[model samples]
Target: MSSQNADVVLVHGAWADGSGWAKVIAPLAAEGFSVTAAPLPLTSFADDVAALERALERKTGPVVLVGHAYAGAVIAAVRSEKVKALVYVAALAPDEGETVADVFYRGEPHPQAPKLEPDSHGLIYLPPDAFPTAFAQNAKADALAVLAASQRPISPASITVPVGRPLWKDRPAWYLIAEEDRMIRVDNQRYMATRMKAEQRSIPADHMPMVTSPAAIVDIIRDAAAAI
Candidate 1:
């Protein structure tokens, strides 16, 4: 399908919601791509996949599914035929039988990366300071404020589960590596991208490039959409 004819779905990772993709949405839409940010419940892996599938069901044409950070695994779990391509932005791509944690912790984390732990309710939250310090270290103070304020706690069940065969194995995939990412180390991003055999684009942005480097993210997604 032509770029304009295909649909684009943006999925946010843990500690984030659809609004995290605000900068990305407009430019893609302006390029004539019908774009929607799919919201994950952050409750469980299965719930996130089901939620993404529901979003796919509502789309009218081929889709370029884009995922950031933790949502990478969520997007890969969907078995949708409408997903014509996969675009991972500093995202994970765990192989069959591997858990998200396996890949996320494959390499050393940036020193400033937060120490995450589940709260009494069993939900893992990104420490507020982590937003400015690691998650989006390159983002401005205003952007950091929005991210911290809108952050959603992710359930432990979301990352601990083993994933089946990933959709990236069957579909064309592109990876955008966040070189300065503190949350997911740059080497981990390279490793995952290489393992998935994805076309890689390196950006000198932090973990949250959709906020700090939207133009680069938009360009890569546009490339993926056009290729499809």
Candidate 2:
């Protein structure tokens, strides 16, 4: 498919900003496709969806909305006709009436996730110790340190708000399972992929595949874009 036919929008997960997609953006853009790395507020589900919707409105042609981790929940909430397909990258593909927290705690607890505490505003922030193992397990120490220092505080409300609609149920979906993920277990990802009826690919990477396996992730998005 021609580059003009598809616009790839990358949505970041919680505890992260748009820079989370920095490693993968160039390669996808190098393929001659228009791309946008959406910087989500990570505040509330509704706010994040609204932010994504605003970004979607900027695209001139059909879009492939790619969500990573918590942003998967965000993308699922924003069901835009302009979005031709949905791609989940080690993302939380929650079902209707489900929330990200529900999916995470339903399964066994992740050892790496630090004990999260809500602030006066009810926003949850990942403690520094959890960053290395939970988020950037494959990244260099220096890079991981930078990420940990800059981690965004997630609004607690996003975890409890049930998804109104799941885009994967209607839109063609693609899922990339990070086999070595420590935060979201591989089994959970597999279950979600199956439930979404998504075309699946597995990579032996950590939670952040876009950082460690950008080419593979980009290829999946490309295939999904072509199929759509």
Candidate 3:
């Protein structure tokens, strides 16, 4: 049941890349898990999912897929049998016929939530200032700066595209609810977790807990691996 024998793939949400999981990676590796931070283009839902598929191709055997934020939707899109379990770290798990946006824009927006829209290039990027404030208030100053500078711009289609029956419906899953998340409302996270019937744990951290609370994420991933 040790994760050391399993392939643990980490998927990051929008406006960020594999580096978002930087804080969690070494720790997971230290514990003997074969970990990978999947790279997503964030161009569109299909594109993101395809990128994840490529990452999966690099691994072998049963895999525990861990997704955060936008990567949640990406993880559910995979049809690979190697994926043994899913870990939703404040992720959005849309059901059949539901778009990521449908779950995202559901409840009243957090008062301080940044207004989002696609730019002239048809991609959406989180504002620089929103990094330290709404996204990861608990992150260190240098970490926040790196995040703001290197963030990716996601296509608006990434949200509007509807999904089919997610793999989570047929696979074992875990949900980590970020209670203080400002990007994706906590209520929305609750609704998704409830509907998916996932094993849930509420953590007192912002959306990017991989940086502020890496141990918690590692613990949850380890637990999920144990069950698998």
**Clashing residue pairs, candidate 2?**
none
Please write out the lDDT profile of model 1 over residues 1-228, one tens digit for every residue.
225968999999999999999999999888788899999998999998999999999998999999999989988999988999999999988999999999988877778989989999999988887887898989999999999999999998999999999999999999999999999999999999999999999989999999999999999988898897
Better of 2 and 3 by lDDT: 3
- TM-score winner: 1
Q: What lDDT, from 0 to 1, does candidate 1 have?
A: 0.92
lDDT of 3 by residue, 101-125 (tens): 9888888999888999888988888
Q: What are the per-model numbers of colliding residue pairs?
A: 0, 0, 0
In model 1, the worst 10-residue window by lDDT is 1-10
lDDT of 2 by residue, 1-228 (tens): 435579999998888887778778888878888989998888788888999999999888899999999988888888689988999999998898888888866688567756777988788888777777777788888778777877898888778888877888889999999998888889999999999999999999988888778888888988988887
lDDT of each: 0.92, 0.86, 0.89
**Predictions ranked by TM-score, top down?**
1, 3, 2
Model 1 residue runs over 4 Å out of place are 1-3
Instruction: Write down the lDDT that model 3 would get.
Output: 0.89
As a whole number from 0 to 100, the lDDT of residue 130 in candidate 2 is 77
* Cα displacement (Å) at residue 94, model 3: 0.5
The most accurate candidate by lDDT is: 1
